[model samples]
Target: MESTSSEYARFLAYGNQLIEVHIGLRDLLADLREGVVPAAELGAHCLAFCAAVTRHHTGEDTQVFPLLAARDPGLRSFLAGLEHDHRIIAGLLTRAGAVAAELRDGSTADGAARLRQELDVVAAVLETHFIGEEKRLVAVLNAIDPSVGLTALTDQAVEFR
Candidate 1:
């Protein structure tokens, strides 16, 4: 049985992948500034990053969040906030994707600067959301045995409630 800490640790590692996207975006921005990374490559990277984010989010929304929310009634408000924050951040990423596509097409359009701006917006929102989520979820970690926690969290998501 994995410990509660172990499962949370796993999820936290997943969270870090989103951070990696932010890092990648910044790197791409640097490339854009230097004309080193082709716009097409950057657009593809952004799309892939977004896809990864969608998967991480699906697991959290469909599996992780439901388990945590059911077990902790006190977290209901915070959970709602988290969901809202996710939508906000996603919007920013969508904008970045648009700008990236434009850039990749070599359109004289103001894509590079717009992409950089949107990326910053999404990154800032995501940072705040992750901080709040960690603060709330950390206490629940280790509150139950690892096996029970993982099973309840991943399998049924409803049993915890």
Candidate 2:
């Protein structure tokens, strides 16, 4: 069977993949907080989450946001806000990663407490950023030329690659 999907659908799928990664990180953090995941694994998990978010945000800033801004000047303010959110999330992720790195064992009371708190903040900020982005940009994305070649953005942001 031949399947045809619009660029908007493809883009949304890509964005959803990033969101799912955030969700997975949230779950992992929750497990860490509950002592379900081994404490020693927390640092590696934090680093992986940080990498995924950096890649996703970099793709958006370099590819998706620039194209959208050029095509629709009215979106400039919204994109700016999103960019600001990205910076904030980046800081939170960095702090979380640092705290995670300090965790010698999941049983480390102070380090685990700090890392869990940092992850909680990251998850909250990410939730807000993702929802706001989808609300503001999904329709615009759908309206963009389907052949505009967003392969770089999608390739980097999507996990299945």
Candidate 3:
């Protein structure tokens, strides 16, 4: 019984770590959207944000999702949906990166506005994705065996800027 309790605690840690990453990403997006980063460095900052998000999704797709699917065959379809969301987010990131490049090159007078628009879309989609993922996966994650090395699931920590 003690072992089961310990495993439950570890599983909850995994969910908490996942939420922490999402919160960090949300904060970074808010910073970008609020113009907290100066124009001179906006391009670099935006690119870094995109990279961090990409890394998070890539880690989930490669490490976390596979493990979850293996643990519960019922989750395969749900995980597929999450993977689809990752692809959508990837496209949004690419668009954001392109706008950031334009801003860096000083090629567009309204580059900031364009970049902001792109980021707005990304934020909306991410909000939906993150909420849905947390709602569905937290319980499942908490039910998994703690001995399964859950640390590897979210080990690719996003560096907060």
Report, for every candidate in turn, its global Cα lDDT versus the true structure: 0.60, 0.69, 0.84
The true-structure Cα RMSD of candidate 1 reads: 5.1
Model 3: residues with Cα > 4 Å off, grouped in runs? 1-11, 145-161
Highest lDDT model number: 3
Model 2 residue 80 CA deviation in Å: 0.9
Best by TM-score: 3
Rank list by lDDT: 3, 2, 1
Candidate 3: tens digits of C-alpha lDDT, residues 1-161: 23544545655776888899999999999999999989877888999999999998988887677767865789999999999999999999999999999999899899998999999999999999999999898878766765654434343432211
Question: Which residue pairs clash in candidate 1?
Answer: none
RMSD of each: 5.1, 5.2, 5.1
Candidate with more favorable, higher TM-score: 1 or 3 = 3
TM-score (C-alpha, index-matched) for candidate 2: 0.72
Assess the local accuracy of residue 148 in candidate 1 as a C-alpha lDDT between 0 and 100: 47
- Using lDDT as the measure, name the better of candidate 1 and candidate 3: 3
Relative to the unseen true structure, what is the C-alpha lDDT of residue 129 in candidate 2, on a scale of 0 to 100? 84
TM-scores, one per candidate: 0.66, 0.72, 0.83
Residues 1-161 of candidate 1: C-alpha lDDT, one tens digit per residue? 55566665665554454455445555654554454756557666666655655555555677657766776677778777777777776777677777777767777366766665766666667667766765565545434444445545444322210
> Lowest summed-lDDT stretch of 10 residues in model 3?
152-161
